[model samples]
Target: MHFNETELPGVGKKITFKNSEGIYTVMILHHNGKREFYYLEDDDDDEPLFSTTLTSEETKELAIKLLGSREDEPDDDSYDHMSLVRKKALVNWVEIKDHSCMIERSVGEAQQMAEEEVSIVAIFREDDLLSKPSDDVMIADGDTLMVLGRKKAVEQFENICKES
Candidate 1:
């Protein structure tokens, strides 16, 4: 089959601009100043009313991919395009916290944990949720890292590193 006939990894095709669901496909704008794929919902009159799509995986996939990419890299990169988000690594929590640590090593520690096959899950900056954490994001005094890893790994990473 041709590319159009098959499921392309990072692409969304407008399926019947007008459907019974009253949905139209429109691109969603992002804060980074990028236009991503989205399925827009419309009415029989084509009066676009609402659209709904994911900014990130409800799980660990997109979050991890987001962490892996450089802050300035274009979102067009294939690595940045995946339909299913990675599941956060299984983990345990002894205490609740956000950042990795205080020292410069904290950054490294975060990477190490990420590399260790444990997912950072979701990060929180105050009340705002940081699903995709940037490398340069500062580890302030009040941040929370939702870690996903093995019970031991999560506990160690949280108690000894992320939370301390």
Candidate 2:
């Protein structure tokens, strides 16, 4: 990878990296803590094939994602690069109600996942995110579960969780 750093004068700093395959990846960091990312094909045109603007926080999050730091980090790839086959599956969110039957049950014990064919990918409780929770992790009231599966199976899993 060859990286070229240049100052954009009134804007900020711009860093461009050309990989071995000749793909150009550019990131421009503005003085206001905003950032712009660009992807260009290995061609003659200087225009970017894809671009997105990110805030300071979002920029940090994107850095973390690119670095593949931890398991809790969200797995998000630019939709521009996604293949058609990956666009079929759907991810849904289910909130566990306080009076629901799934409360106080461990993920393994509830068996909602096994029976419905839905997989729990992450759990959100208050300000915390529990990513790829183990079977021993207990489901709690008000916890939001990120479930991935076919549409029908996801709906079935939600119905099971929302049932009192």
Candidate number with greatest lDDT: 2
Q: Global lDDT of each model? A: 0.43, 0.70
lDDT of 2 by residue, 1-164 (tens): 67789976434578988877777888876543457788888635566888888865687677788987855553344321221223355565577999888888887676554465667788999889999988789999999887776555765787888778
lDDT by residue for model 1 over 1-164, one digit each (tens)? 11112222222222324445655555433221223444445324333455444443322345457689546543433433322223223332122334445434443356475334555545665557776565565555555565555434554565566444
TM-score of each: 0.34, 0.45
Runs with alpha carbons beyond 4 Å of true place in candidate 2: 1-87, 111-114
Counted clashes in each candidate structure = 14, 0
How high a TM-score does candidate 2 get?
Answer: 0.45
Worst 10-residue lDDT window, candidate 1: 1-10
Model 1 accuracy (lDDT, Cα)? 0.43
